[model samples]
Target: MTIAIVGGTGPEGSGLALRWARAGEIIIIGSRDAQRAADTAVKLAEKIGGKSSRVSGAENKAACAGAEVVVLTVPFEAQAETLKHIKPALRPGQILVDTTVPLAASVGGKPTRTLGVWQGSAAQQAAELVPEGVAVVAAFHNLAADLLQLDGPVDCDVIVCSDDKEAGKRVRDLARKIPGVRALDGGKLENARIVEQITAVLIGLNIRHKGHSGLRITGLPAEAYEK
Candidate 1:
């Protein structure tokens, strides 16, 4: 499937791209600047190997145009503008994956006031911005940039929550491409608030650990009770 990474130059974009590329999926990296977008494409082409065609780069709209699925990897600040640019290009059945974490860091690298998401959350905001046809899925919010930069087995799982079951499943399938990871369906779109709060806790963990820490959830998959 053709998946377009709308904010592909960012850390989240690169991480998702690397994982999906390793899974042999065609990835198109999109950026505000044509040059930067093309650069990411070139890098992926070299790593994944092809006629330099397996991966490609394009300016925002072009990258999103005709894509079966689209992911938003831009910063919280950029998400609005990027979506405005990409809204016109979205398809009927396309899914928009949001990996944005809204936190305003102070000069000292600590956040003073946590940024509550505009219009509920990055995912919900994206859904409202896009045409009603597009389905927005919140995922990969807590994944470390370092983990995505690696070439093999990602150790973290992404929590996916969406109002649309098929859209959620589409992203769930996308998450499966990365090794040592699983995508847990986080019920419905409203559950994104809980999922997003986890990022803040994880950030605190990273600070305490002094590294790009990862997170996983247990206590799932209950066994069926016998009659």
Candidate 2:
């Protein structure tokens, strides 16, 4: 699939681009500054080495225009504005994967705390802003950017929530492309309120443990993901 990473200049965006690129998927890094996005894409391509022609870069709107899936990796403060800037390019039948977390850190507060989004969660807010018929799936809230950049497995579970069942499954399939990652069905988009908040708690745990910690759900059979 052609995946566009909006805000691709950021750590999270770049990290995901790197992983997906290595996985042999076509990756487009999108940024407000097209030149910066291009530069980051070049760096990622170089890192991947040998015929990494599948990765490229473009402006946010242009990136969203050509992509089958657009992944938003921006901070909460920039989510609405970024979506607004690229809204025109988002057409019907496109799946938008939102990785935003409304952390207090965006408002000069603690990173271990979350801000209350009037729309209930950042993903829901994204759903409200996008044009009609564009499906929004919330995921990657618990994955660490630093871990994604590393060479080996990330060892985490990505909780994917979307009202659109097919879109949710598509994202879950994409999430499994990363090593050591399991994707779970997190129900409706409204459930994102709970999933997004878990990031704050994970941040707190990371601070205390001095290591990046991730989530894992037990007791479910392997068939759970198949359904």
Candidate 3:
């Protein structure tokens, strides 16, 4: 699938781009500045071997133009503006994955405390801003950025939530492509608020333990994933 990571210049965005690119998926790194996006993609491509042909960079709109999936990994503060900026380029058949957390991590406020989002959650806000045809899903909220940049596998469970069941499943399948990662259906989009809040708890755990933290749900039948 052709995946576009908007604000792909940041660590979270770049890390995901790197992993997906290494997995042999076509990746487009998007940035406000086309040059910066291109530069980052070039550097990242060199890291995984000089095969830069599969991965490229472009302005946000250009990146989303032909992508089958668009992931928004910008900070919470920029989420609204970024979605608004990309709204025109979003089409009805595409899926937009939102990994935004409404945390005060950027400000002086505690990371465990989430800021109030009038639209319920960042994913909900994104759903509201996008055009009718675009399906919005929330995921990857608790994945550690540092872990993503590593060459080894990541041990975690990705809980995917969306009002659109098919869109949510698509994202879950995409998440499963990552090594040692399991994807679980997290119900409706409204449940994203709960899923997002777990980020703060994980963040707090990471800080106290001085290590990257992740989630793993147990007791499910092993055959459940067969489908």
Candidate 4:
């Protein structure tokens, strides 16, 4: 199974690419520029203790063409533009993972405790735009890429929201490759808003704490999900 990551040059994309590369081969790092993408693939390979051949790079559309899954980690504002260019290329049954956070920039460089949600969360917007044939799964919102790049363990839990149960399960399995990371189903696509907003809270925590990173969710009853 080949996993292709769109906008993989960024931190979130880089971490995901590295994790998957360590566990499996045939990982593609997608970028707007083919050369940049190739460079990202090489760096990812090194991070995972692998050689270059196991990974490759491609332009955004080409990256999604035949891959089993494609993840988007482009910036919030750039999300729509990036997906607009690649929407036609997404294949049927391919899992489209969205990790974009919809929080807006703070004014006057003032770190205000506020959440700027788009009409809907980033995941919802992406899923709405993507063709129905593609299974859009929302996840990786609260994780700090710093935690993911370290070789030891993921040490975090990801809240996964998807309309497609099977696709959500695939993402869950993919999350397993990260040493300590666990993926929990957060129910249908509508729940994406809940998961995406946690980033705002995390940001608030970081601002108040001054430099602490990594947001993890824990503690739940025996029968309680989202633990």
State the lDDT of candidate 4 residue by residue for 10-92, as single tens digits.
88898888877777747888999999999888777776674557688999999989798999989776888988989999868
Please report the TM-score between candidate 3 and the true structure: 0.96
Model 1 backbone overlap count = 0
Off by over 4 Å in 3: none
Cα lDDT listed for each candidate: 0.79, 0.93, 0.90, 0.80
Error of 2 at 146 (Å): 1.0
Which rank order by lDDT, best down to worst?
2, 3, 4, 1
**Tens-place lDDT digits, model 1, residues 77-114:** 78788899888888787888888776665222344224
- Order the numbered candidates by TM-score, best leading: 2, 3, 1, 4
Cα-based TM-score, every candidate: 0.91, 0.98, 0.96, 0.89
How high is the lDDT of residue 191 in model 1?
76
| Residue 139 alpha-carbon offset, candidate 4, angstroms | 0.4
Clashing pairs in 3: 92-133
Residue pairs with backbone overlap in model 1? none
Stretches > 4 Å off in candidate 4:
106-119, 210-212, 219-227
Expressed as tens digits, the lDDT of each residue in 1-227 for candidate 2 is: 99999998899999989888888889999999889999999999899997479889999999999899999999999999999999999999999999999999999999999999999999999999999999999999999998998899998999999999999999999988898899999999999999999999999999998998889988999977555
Which stretches of model 1 miss by more than 4 angstroms?
50-52, 106-113, 222-227
TM-score of 2: 0.98
